[model samples]
Each structure stands twice: as structure tokens, then as C-alpha cells.
Target: MRLALTSDNIAGACEAVVAEMIKAAQGEAMPYGGDPLTEQVTKMFAELFECDVAVFLVSTGTAANVLSLAALTPPWGSVLCHPESHIVNDECSAPEFYTNGARLVGVAGEEAKISVSALEQAINKRMGDVHSVQPSAVSLSQVTEIGSVYSLAELQEISQLAHSKGLKVHMDGARFANALVSLGCTPAQMTWQSGIDIVSFGATKNGAMAAEAIVVFDKNLAQKLALLRKRGGHLHSKMRLLSAQMLGYLSDDVWLNNARHANAMMALLQKGMASIAGVEIIAPAQANMLFCRLPVGMAEALLAQGFSFYTGRWEEGVVRFVTSFQTQQADVEDFIACARDLSTSHTKTS
Candidate 1:
């Protein structure tokens, strides 16, 4: 069995999501999210969020995030976010492209969660200045890139601060389900109720075939987001497949279940790694992702032994690991066992 500790995106579609896609494939879907299934999925999200909001379906997390920001930010505007946020570091300037030149200003902080003080500094540094990029909005990642989660209190603080400064709060919730299940909070409590104006609710990362939602809590922002999505070329034709995936993911609470399993397996891997030598967790393994540093050779050895994970540069001799919705306990144990053996071999050699 191959152990996977790469990214949640590496996991396959959940069976429920796949089955729904198959079911949708049999019908002629109304193009561009006009189908009844899309309406149902959007309604489910509004209910899950415990409020009336506008939802736009898209095919990728980048599209969801970029388009959501595009709806809120004007040209010559700037978005405040963590230095390591996916949109800042990984999206290849899709946010810039979508926002028609809105810039992303990286906030400095530990744990990959922006500190209110730091945000204040970043915002204050660019005030009343025509030459400086004006701060237009703030984006907070629910489960941050380092696998650290923002508590509701933390989100509230950030939200309050952003609003106080007249900046809209946008959440890049690529792992919204994982963070929700981890926090055990109602969707509203985690989002609009806490001052978030918009959210990029992701399904592709959790278990969908390929889908995400840009949810605008502010009714006024909805029309703009819909237009932006269409202009960005994300409006899907025969979009029922996308809606079907979300329908299955949310139906019967499969989304929560899959996220819970992924989180549990990460916990198991973390616990197992704690007992091994030369392994140190770089971040709290709260969600499906884990950022840990292991001995140099262990990554290579694990790959040789049929394990898969991204070994991000770990200083001089360490690497990172991740877990996903499909991670099995056996896979976790086997990877740990391999690490244990590698540790022993290294010790003997030294």
C-alpha cells in the first residue's frame, strides 16, 4: 500500500462525490449553474452558513479566491494576507490578473496567521498616499499553509481590526470543512457572524472531483462576484457535475466525515512521529495538513519504499509531510515504521 502525505489535493474524489457526478452525467444539465442541482447546492451552503448569501461555483481554488477578491477589490487596491498564504505564494498572480491589478501585501507573523498588530502596521504604512498601494481588503486562510488553524477568537480579532480600518475581510477557505470540523463551530459562527464579508468555500481539496464556491455574505457583493466569475472564464457549462459533486459532499454530511477522517489520520501520524527520533513537527497538525521536519534520508527512503509526500526544504536536513481524506491508519503506521527504521540506520551509521 502506498502511503500518501503530500497534499489533500492529492487525494481522489470521495466515493459519494463520484457517485453523484455519475448520476448527474446521465442528464442534460442546464449550462452555467442554471440547473436545479446547482440551486440546491447553493441553498445548502447558505443554510450551512446559517445566513442568506450568494454562492458562485468554480472549477479551482485559485479561481474561487481570485474572483472573490476581484469582486471586493478595485484596481490599484491591495489585499492584506499572511506572507505564506496560498494566494500570495502559489496562485501565480491569478489574484492580480483577476482583480485587474490589485496587489497582495504579505503580512509578517508566525504560525501563518496574521497578527492584528502586524496588520495594523502593514495598513498604517500605506495610508493617505496615492503612490502606495491602497489597502482594500484582508484575506485570512482558515487552516493556514503551515497547517495551523485560526481559532474563532483569532478570526474575530482579525475581522474586527480589518473592519475598523474599512477593509473587507475575505476568507480563503480552501479547507473550510477541515477547519470547521476541527473547530466544531457552526458555519455562521466561523464566518459572516464573525465579520467575514466573503469566503472562498472549497470542495476540490476535501473530496470533490473539481469544484469550489465563492460565497458573498454581503448581498450587495453578489452581483459583482457573478459578473467577475463569468468574465474570468470560470462559468462552467453543463455545470451540474460541479454542483453534483458538492451536493454529494454536503449530503448525508459526507464533507464533515471525510474531513474528520483526514484530521484523525493526521493526528495518528503526528502521535506516531512524536515517539520516533529525528522527527519534529513544524506546525500544529490540526487540519488535514502537517508540517514536520524529519531526517534528510527518511524522505528519500520513504519514497523508495512507495510513500508519497512533499519534502519541502527543511533547513539543512529536514522535510515536511501531509495527510489527506483517503489516508488509512495502516498507511500512517507503515510510514512511521519506515521512519523508525531509517532513524535506526542513521544512528548506527553515525
Candidate 2:
């Protein structure tokens, strides 16, 4: 079997999502988010968060993220985020384009998470400077790029600081469910309760086909964001399809269950990798994603065995393994066994 640990979205749609999509296809309904399914999805999200929220469905996380940022910031404003944040490193400047040239200021921090002090410094750096972009918002990634999840206290501290500085807080929740399950907190507690103004609630990475939500906690931004989403050409006409995926993802706690399973698989992988000689865990594996360094030969051996993962993105020997709802335990065990064998052979040969 070719084991793939590349990313969750690569695993394809989950069974429930497929079923929901089929059901959606069988019925004709209103378009442009005027359908009942879309309305239900909005209510479902509001219920999930334990507060009234405006949920706008989009086909991609990038759309969800950039539109949310655009709603929070102005052309002359900037968004403060960690240097390794998806908006800064992975989005290919879509944020800048959506915000009409708003700057993304990278704040230095460890493990892909922005510390309150670092964010404060970044925000204060250009305050009232006409030559510099004013910090208007702060973006945080739940289950950060390096797999480190911010504690509720950490989130609260950062949100409080940003709000005190007149900055809106946005969460790029591409792995929201994973981080939520890891933190063992309610969705509301992780977001609005922590002072987050908006969230790019991602389902594609978790289990859905291509459903991502721009969940607005700050009701004031909802109308403006709806307009921005349309202007950005992200408002899907067959919106029920997107809404159905979210409906299925949320039904019977499928989202949470999927995240728990993925996290469990990652914990098993982390444990196995820890025992392999010359493998170094480079970050805190708090969610389904893990970053580690492997001996070149061991990595090559694993690849030879048809096990696939990301490598050399962060550094020379560092690799990333992302577990998904569909990741099989057997594949994980096989990978570990192969790595152990390779490590042993290399040690003996040397």
C-alpha cells in the first residue's frame, strides 16, 4: 500500500459528506445561499458556537481566510501574524490582493504561534506612522503550522492585547476541529469567547469535500463580509452543496470524531517515531500534524518503501506528516516498522 501522510485534504471526502452531497444533488433548491440548507448550516454553526454567528460558505480556505481579513482590515491597514502563518507563507499573496494591498506583518515567534509580546511589538511598531501600514488585525492559526495548539489562556491573552490595541482578531481555523479536540474545549470557548472576531472554519482538511466557512463572530462585519465574499467571486451559486457538506460534517459530531481519530493516530505515530534512533521531533505534536527530522538514509528508505510525506520544506532534513480522518493505523505501524529497521541497519553499518 502506498501510505500517504501528506495532508488531510488529499484523503478526499468522507462517507457522510458524500452521502450529503448526493442528497443535495437530488433536490433542487435556491441558489446563491438562499436555500434552506444554507440557512440550516448557519444555524448549526451558531448552535455549535453557542452564540449567534454569520456563516458564509466558500469553496476554499484561502477564500474564507482572505475575505475574513479583508472584512477586518482596510487598504491602509495591516494584519499581524506569525511568520509561519498560512496567510504569510502559503496563501500566495491572496490576502494582500483581497485586502486591496493591506500588508501582512510577520511577527517572530517560536513554533509557528504568535506570542502576545511579539504581536504587541508588531502592532506598536507602525502605530500612527503614515509611512507604515497600521496594524488593524491579528491572525492566528489554531493547531499552528508546526502542530502546536495555543492554550485558551494563550488565546485570551493575545486577543485581549489585540483588542486593547484596536485590532480585530481572526483565526485561520484550517484545523479547527483538531485543535478544538486537542484543547478539550467547546467551540465557543476557543473562538468568540477568546475574543476572536472571525474564523475561517475549515472542513475540507478535516473530512468534507471543499467546504470552508467564514464564521463571523463580530456581527458588525457580517454584512460587509457578505459583500466582500461576492466581490471576491467566492459566493457559489450552487451553495447548497457546500452547505450540505458542513451539515454532514457537523451531524452526530462527525467533525469531532474525525479529529479525535486523526489526533489518536498522530499520537501513536509520535510514540513510535520517538523510539527510532536519529529521528528528532522538532515541534510539539499537539494535533494531527507533526514535524520531525529524520536521517537522510532512513527517509530515503521510507520513500523507497512507498511511504509518502513532505520533506525539506522547513529545512534540509525536516519532514512533515499530517494525519487525516482516513489515515489507517496499519499504514502508520508499517511506516514505524520500516523506519526502525532502516535506523537499525544504518547504525550497524556505521
Candidate 3:
């Protein structure tokens, strides 16, 4: 039936998370994240990270990222990140707004994973120059925009570089679970233990109703993040609902399971696509995303078949197919079949 290959938000909430929210709604709990559930969820996150991390819940990934950057950077500072990163491109100045005028300096990277060299150059270009903003933070995406995953070693190299240059590292982990599941690495291995200072742990895109957490590894930055999230108007009055979503998502490793399924679907889609005619993969299918170029006719036919995905500005022949936790294997097969049929029809017509 209805196949969604647009974004992870198309996925519905997990039953456990839904039940937790319903249960939370039945109680007379304190508001503004002072409730027991919120406290318990934060504790769970801390334990998961294997450190006393500060966890702040937000309604969206953008809020989690922008608010975390606000806590890390000052008004006059800047954040160094890949040119195609969500924080630099998707946030639409949310980082700047939350940071009271901090700017983002984009580094050159193909898959939105900041290379140590590119980061160093980007930060160096802004240094020893009063006219330019000072580099205060470096942000990287775990599962990059081009569907590439950063290895733990790569993250360590980038993190060590940022810290050596007196900058903190922030990770826009919108597809964190996808990357983590693929890497088969613990959260701590990809983060704090590897020099990450904060992470925007995304849940809405996975299976939660609407939830994201800003994880601050450094305790000193915790108070500032709390104040910033409150001032940014992200402090939910009925914060237990958000907490419930996160708690249930992480309760029995549902988050990892969901991500694993999504990644598997992407892999299947990628394999099916590679066998088709006139279809080329633009990037490696490392996580839940598949960036590829299809024949103009096949792209148009797929669009006509109720298959929805980005055409990347309606170019002559290119598209982006995004898989999610809810993307079914049958849907992937149907889409591949559609592409095959379209290619055959186009050949006959031509």
C-alpha cells in the first residue's frame, strides 16, 4: 500500500512508547521536567552513556542541536561543521539565534563527516583574525547527509583535533541510532570516550512521537544548557510526555532494533537498485538513507506511482530515497519493481 520513503518522521511511535505516554498522562506529575519520569529517563541516559551525562529533552532535533550549540558557543564564537551538515544547512540559523549571534563555518566534506584536515583548515581560517569569528565548537553528523557513517577512529581524530584547538565537539546525531547499530559500537565509544562533548540524541526520527535529547558529557555545561533550553522556549510544561517517549524507546533496546530494521531496508533497497539499468548510487548506503540517480523516465514513473522522495530540484534525472524504521521490505521491493517496469517501458517507447 502506502509506502513512505521520504523521511524518518513518517514512522509511527512504538507501542511501548505510546503506552508509557498514556500511563504518564494518568498521573498528577510535576511539570517542567521536574517529574519523576523525566528524572528517571535522564538517569537511564546517563547509565547508557556510562557516564554522568546531563540529558535535556526537547520536542525536536533542531531544538536539541541549537540549544546544545548555544550552551557550547558564546555570542561572538563560531561552530565548524561540514558544509552539508544539518546544523549548518537544515537549522536555518537556529544555532546562531540560540547562541546569541554565533556563526557556522562550513568545512568541505563529501558525506557531511568533517575530516580532521578540513576542520583544522576551517578553524585556522577564522583564527588570528579579529574580523572573523572565533572557533568555539566543531559539529559532526554521525550518519552524514550523504548516507555515510563515521567510524570511531575518524570521530576520535576529529574530536582530538577540535579539543587540541581549544574547541568543544558537538554531534548532530539525528540518525545516531542508525549509525550506532551499523557500527556495532557502544554509545560511549562513538561519543564522550572519543572526545565528543555533547550529542543531539534524536528519537522522533526513529519511533518516538516527538522527542530529542541534548546530552552534555561535561557537567560544567549542564547548567548553561538548562538555562538556554528554558530561555529558548523549549522547556515543556508537560515534560513527562517527552520523557516517556524516550524512556520507552530505550527501555528494552527498541531504539537499536528499529534502527537495525531501517538500515536493513536501506541495504536491500541499495542492492535492488544497483541491479537496475541507468540507476547509479551517488553515495554509499551506510545508514537509513540511499542517495542515487535514476533514469529520467523511471524517476518520473516512480513519482507517478505514488512513490514519494526528493528529486533534488527536479533535475533531468536524479532522486534521493530515504528509508526509515517503518519502511517495509515489501515496499522496497515494489519500488524496485516499479523502476524496472519503467525502464522497460521507456526502452520500448524510445
Candidate 4:
């Protein structure tokens, strides 16, 4: 059984992107994002988002998030995020560093989606107290750390609440396409129409090689972000390679197709795991990831049998299985079989 916890390891850049990169390497293009392909993808994103969006291409998701947040918040202001959000848990205070000491306050929520009431309370918790970090932004992770995505209604409620409180909304969309395919909503509905002010539109985690974008809905933020990206050393001189990958990713709805396949594989794995005697689906298997608890020792046994995955990374007593466009049906079934065999043997002994 073969499984990978991160998209970087599961599959390489899609074939389309590989071909584009090779083509880009053989040709001459303008440096520092002046190439035609870079300009074209920017237009493509605006069309897809159904609005005029300022798009900045970057090599990493962390840079995308930090730069976007830096543009929106000041050193003393705070950005709200779910406890398990990638910004809060994984980014190593880069948001604070990029924003020059801005704080990241955790908002409580169920299934990794921040709750509205908790967010409102947090926003106003230290409203005028100079001692506390004033809430200036709310960062949401689409297809959250535990794989649950906020529904369209849920996103709208949170965004509206944040905007009403004079706070901007940002989405860490590392798995943007996966969440989009899962929700079956248009890009505008999920972000700007729902009041999101900015997005770190991540394509690297899906199928692109080191391509991520910072998409700004607010023109004011976009203006500041341009300087920040260049000053922060994220601006690539040979930028067409990144642009080409994004172009390949978005063309003909390839991103949506890849997401659909990954989600379907997760659904298959989640369903089969649920039927096993000693397995527990720990979180909502909403997208291309699953968080489940196996019979004690089952995880170790499965690993011994050649399955590679993430266990106890997010929490103890649970394992994470991430499916990508490259995951095959046979791998899913074989994994399920391995778990069942261990569960059955453990049950008989007990």
C-alpha cells in the first residue's frame, strides 16, 4: 500500500506543467514577471474569479500568506485564525514577522472551521485596550487542517461578521481547488462575494511545481503587496516558469478535474475505513483528506506492510491519509485491506 501525506510527495508537477516548463526553458521571456504568459495567467485568474483581481505569483505558500497579511495588518494588530490553521500552527510566526509583530489570535470552531460567535468575541475582545492586540484581519484555511471545508453559507456568515467588525478576511487557499470542487460553488461566491479581502491562492499543493499566488480583492492591499513581494525577495526574475505552471494548472479546468479525482479517492477510502471493525473516522472526511483512528498497533502494523502516511501529526490516536490526483484505486483498496486484516486479528485475540 502506497500513500503520501503531502501533495509534494504524492505526485510531481502535472504532465501539462512539465511540458510547459520545458517549453519555457527553451524560449526567451521577459524577466521579473514581464513575460506574456505571466500577464495571461493574471487575466485568466481575474476571469475565473469573476472580478478584476491583482495577482502576484510566488514560489511558496508561506510567502503568499505572509505577504498578503503584511499588506492588510500592522505590527500591533492581530489576525484571527482557527487553532489548527496552517498559519497559526505551521508557519512559525511568519505572519507576525512579515507584519512586523502582528499577533495571531485563535478562534474556536468545530471541525476546524472557526465559529462566528467566537470570532466576533475575539474581534472585540480587546477593542480599545492598548495592551491587547487589536483584531484587524481574519485568516481562514479553505479545506481546513482536518479536511473539513466551510460551506458557502458558513463562509458568508464569517466574512460578513468580520467585515462588520472592521476586520479584513483572508483565506489560506493551499488546497483551493480541492475545496472549490468539494463545495460546487463559483470562485466569486466562495471568496469576494462572501467578503474575503485577500487569498493566498496555492497551486503547489495540488499539481503545480512551486507555484502559488497572492490574489487581492482590495485594490489598496494590492498596492502595498507589490512592494512587499519585491522587497521580501519572493519576486522571481525568471518568472515565466511559475507562470507557465499556473497556466497549465488552470487551463481546460484541469485543477477542478484533479481535485475531483482526489476527492473521489478519499471518499472511497473513508467509506471503506468506516466499515472496518476497529477504525474511527476522527474528523469529517469532507475533501481529499481523512483523519481516522485505527485499532491500537494497527497503524504500526500497516506501516510495516509498506504503507507510508502521516500518523499523530495533528493529534494522537489518529492518522492522516491524503489522496492526490496521482492516487490509484488499487492503493486505496490495498490500504483498506491491510487495516482490516490487522483489525480482524486483534479482534480474534481480544
Query: Which candidate leads the pack in TM-score?
Result: 2
Q: Give the number of colliding residue pairs in candidate 4.
A: 0
lDDT of 2 by residue, 318-350 (tens): 999999999999989988988898999899999
Model 1 RMSD to the real structure? 1.2
Per-residue lDDT, model 2, residue 14, is: 91
Model 1, 1-350: lDDT tens per residue? Answer: 59877788888999999999999999586788889999998899878888888888888999989998998889899999998999998999999998889999999788899988999999899677999889989998998888888999989999998898889999999999899999999889989988999999988888998989888899999888778778888888888989999999999999898889989998888888888888887786788777777776777788898888776554654556767788889878888888899999998998
Indicate whether candidate 1 or candidate 4 has the larger lDDT: 4
Q: State the lDDT of candidate 3 residue by residue for 1-350, as single tens digits.
A: 45768788877898888999999989599999989999999899988999898899999999998998998888889988888888877888888888999988888876667777778888888586899799999988888988899999999999889899899999989889999999999999989989999999998889899999999999999898888888899999999999999988999999999999999999999998999888888887899998888876676677778988878653557677788888888889988888888877877888
**Cα error of candidate 3 at position 279, Å:** 0.3
The TM-score obtained by model 4 is 0.97
Candidate 4 displacement at residue 116 in angstroms:
0.6
Candidate order by lDDT, highest to lowest? 2, 4, 3, 1
Whichever of 1 and 3 has more lDDT, that candidate is 3
How many clashing residue pairs are found in candidate 3? 0
Q: Which structure among the candidates has the greatest lDDT?
A: 2
Model 3 CA lDDT for position 227: 88
How many residue-pair clashes does candidate 2 contain? 0
Cα lDDT for residue 225, candidate 2: 90
